[model samples]
Target: MALLARRAARRSAASTKAAAPPAAVAVELSIPAHFRCPISLDLMRDPVTAPTGITYDRESIEAWLDTGRAAVCPVTHAPLRHEDLVPNHAIRRVIQDWCVANRSRGVERIPTPKIPLTPVQASELLFDLAESRDTAAAIARVRALARDSERNRRCLVSVGAGRVLASALASLAADGETPAAALEDVLAALVCMTPLDDEAARILATPTSLGSLVAIAENGSLAGRLNAVLVIKEIVSCIQLTGNVVEELVDALAKVIKAPICPQATKAAMVATYHLASSSERAAAHAAGAGLVPVLVESLVGADKSAAEKALAVLDAVLASEEGRTSARAHALTVPVLVKKMFRVSDLATELAVSAMWRLGRGAKESEEGEATKCLVEALRVGAFQKLLLLLQVGCRDATKEKTTELLKMLNKHKGVGECVDAMDFRGINRLS
Candidate 1:
């Protein structure tokens, strides 16, 4: 009832101001000096009281600390640990009230900010999740808090929510009878707490946790599968993955691609696959053996520019291994797909596709001379030779330009017996680089 009365009074005040006398409206109103953050010189929405006894907008101060140049107070230059910054509720209310009073002057109301989660609150929420008590509500509450503000996310992370969630998932992996829907909810909340600390990464890197995530990536709902792939990507980035773990990651990615979820999931899997293949030769060979090259080859045919670029980059890295080359060489679509992707998607994609074609054209084994002849013949059949010449006639990156020239030379050297190295169609051409 008191809250209702306060809102009614706020409305009355605004109506009064909106109907004020002309002279009263003529007087220019200004924000109080104290209401402006010293760092931003702007009205403070989320005013936090720093240890220096000065208040600044939350985002401004957080940005100051993220610079990592110094941890000292931005105002006082005194040593400051940001964890002590408290929400200045009193100031926030005043600022909001003032905005309401001046609404006729185009003042916009700042909705009340959500109360940040105290460490105790965060711990209790994690406890509920960990203890399996009303688990869905707990996951929803945790996710709601995380989505509330950067401050809430920081508080959750500070209290070790990452490790707790990872441990919970690890337990799910160990105990098989649990419904996978719970895993989905827990993972849904867990995905937002990214850049997980070393301990959390280590925990999720365990075999059981990875196995559960792989299972989700392969068979869970699209949202759950995307979150799983994302978590797997983060874990791979954070820790030193073993051969078996790398293989598992590759297999998950391959499965996701084969199933064809949303673009986000495919891109995540591609990024992870690229990282795994580039990490080591053995991993690259494993990726090829898992049929990544053929899958990428098929996917690249009509892919959008970004996906094509990423797929080509992964294909390039995978082709560095003999296994990748052999696998791609064995594919009927490899040469044609490489040719189709050339000079079309992006500079990077064009460069990678050209490199992949060269690798396939010059197979590692002398006994594969027939493969090389077929590769060149297929390139001619698909007009790859013409595309290479045009790539030079137009412009490209310096390194890509070099690769294009090398490919042109190879084509020239292996031309049909009578074809005098066909001069580039430089009709309106200026000096070539």
Candidate 2:
């Protein structure tokens, strides 16, 4: 009995302690005003002085410059004469020292920031990398330079390193003895050169370089494939592609989309396809025949609004051809997916979806009345008629409404669609009747 009483007392005390609220720690740590960045209002990691003589975090200031959001300093509001940003090494050291001194307050010491390479320095590095006997080391150095800072990346492009990187990739492809690591680095460098200028893009658009990129897209690692796609996208966007180049891009992008290594890479591949397909009708037919319909349908089913919009646009372009229409009709989910997206995504997406349906329906109408009637019945069975009528009632673009009217009239002409039409409460149907 005595032991039992003691055990019960201990349990009650333990329960009380466990249920009690935790006490707040009262350590107050204040950051010195000089240590904070004027823009971010946080301790600076890499302080840099702009032309306005105001010190700000390097990333914040660079972002401001890159975005063209402001031509003046955030702190002084003085117009900048030039966009020169010099590193404030002295302030950085002071901030690091303060962090170290306040270590007990959970402060972390900031590492020394790497100095961004100048245009001349970047050119020299690229030259050495291209001429290096040690290919592996050269590749590693190139990747490190790319990962260093955005400023360095800009420097590389300013000094023509983009062309050098393209040449290296082309040479490697020609050698056929290039290591995977080296190839990946070259691809990464090219991608890092964002918004490639016309000169750099033309350099990468060469046949040998493009073939290498296609090879990488087809068989490289996930990162390599994504980089290749991104580089191709930039190249195609900046330069006018020739007939052969468009064919090559279509083939590579089609393969990448079929087994997309990643979601982002798939989106890149799709955008590239859209760019190429917009160039010619023959390219659209080629992309459609290369198994793009099913992939696009799959993407629409799972994509977010932006991705779905792009996918619909591509579908709209490609569906203009008979081969594209046939491929879309052959895909089991295409019609249902289009109907589902009619009013669910964006206005642009809606327009594109309705247009694709109009094209497909028109194609069916051209293939004998019986075949057209059968296709109309199938569309009605998938709730397409209800969605189209609702689209008309809710208001769409004038062009889209017109297309919707045509599609609805075509469907209502089918004798079997009477039941599908009656199921809708949309008053817009009276016009069709």
Candidate 3:
């Protein structure tokens, strides 16, 4: 009887014992497991659910879809399409609220993600642009969507919006001049939707393409001209423009450099010029004839570093041929300009500048007359000799060093050997000492 009474008393004492303090019991709250992306394993900012019931940050999933894997969900390997990745706004809201609640823990609130333009919507927009029924609204919508996100751009490109936009740019021929505002809108969207597909490249290769782009580059608004030049750079990269078309393209690019709307415009113009001149000697000749050299030289006066480099690159390509060299030699600023570009700009600028000068030397050397000696004297007169020596002093790549040495010897030959060497002040120049 005594043991049974003690056992009952112990059971009641254990049941009446106080629980742990709530202050100490409650620790930090963990984020919900479903709030994280499967691919990134991080909290989802823009949670989007795939067709297979897996959620990911929109950027992560879009990348998975774009890299030739659009047919399957990354997590489940189920069939999917680019059009079916639905945004989980409810989950996004929850994730954001969680972030807000944990503000003291360095957790930042995720921004509301942009709604991506679906491929279906992009297709409809393309149709609207093509039919010219809701042209203005369609153009504005396309521009907005293209500027929104890379995924939207991919969607636009997939539905052939790039080609249609290029067509809109060239439509001045068939439908008369479209409104300038409308054209500029189309240009902005086209600029955003780049790396045009093979079909778009073929469309840009047509004769009308060059004409339309040139008109815009020469006569459009500053923004329009900038966009036009950017598109021209892309278009010229793929197509083989020639004959009168090359001349026209050169003229437009030269005009841009001569009176640039912006540095971007000038640089893009230089890139387009390099593309045309670098491949074909005929194109180089055409560029020279269209008066591009002087324009590039003049643009270099107060230009920034990158612009200077591009200008020199264009000059190097243009001066590769005999006709281009002839035009440059006639220009008063050619040698002085080349000399000034040496060592003051980037290594690429120096290399391009030296290459152009060497081309002039070679061209002058191969002539029937004694122009090589005249060229050497003229280069010396422009102070190119010491720059070449300074080139050697600073140490250069093997090729540039070899050319500089040859040019030095040529200067020695023409200026009476001792006279050329006597001009050197070897204070800082150690390599030639």
lDDT of each: 0.81, 0.78, 0.77
Count the clashes in each prediction.
0, 0, 0
Q: For each candidate, what TM-score against the reference?
A: 0.71, 0.81, 0.71
Top lDDT prediction, candidate number: 1
Model 1 TM-score, all chains together? 0.71
Winner on lDDT (1 vs 3): 1
Q: For candidate 3, what is the lDDT?
A: 0.77
lDDT of 2 by residue, 1-433 (tens): 9999999999998887665432111123567787778877777889998877788988877777678666777777877523477889899999888878876656677899887777777777877877855756665676678778777777777777777777777788777787766788878877777777787787778787788788888788889989999998888788768777688788989988888687788888888888888778888888888888878877787678888998988888888767788888777677678877887789999999899888777774455445445556767866788888888888988898889999999877763754645453434322220
Q: In model 1, which regions exceed 4 Å deviation?
A: 1-34, 38-42, 72-80, 103-108, 118-140, 239-251, 278-295, 298-306, 320-351, 376-412, 415-433
lDDT of 3 at 163: 90
Clashing pairs in 2: none
What are the candidates' C-alpha RMSDs? 9.9, 7.0, 13.3
On TM-score, the leading prediction is: 2
| Candidate 3 residue lDDT tens string, 1-433 | 9999999999887665434332222223456788877887667778888777888888887777777855788767888876677889999998888878877655667889877777788898899889876777887888888878888887788888989987776674345566666667777888888877666767766676667777888888889889888988887888767678877888888888877687788888999899989879888887787787887776666657898889889988988767788777777667767777786778988988888888777664357135545556677766788889888988999988888888887777666533554454423222210
Better of 1 and 3 by TM-score: 1
Model 1, 232-278: lDDT tens digits are: 87887778787587888898898887677889888888888888888
Runs of candidate 2 with Cα error greater than 4 angstroms are 1-28, 51-53, 81-83, 127-139, 174-181, 239-248, 368-372, 389-402, 415-433
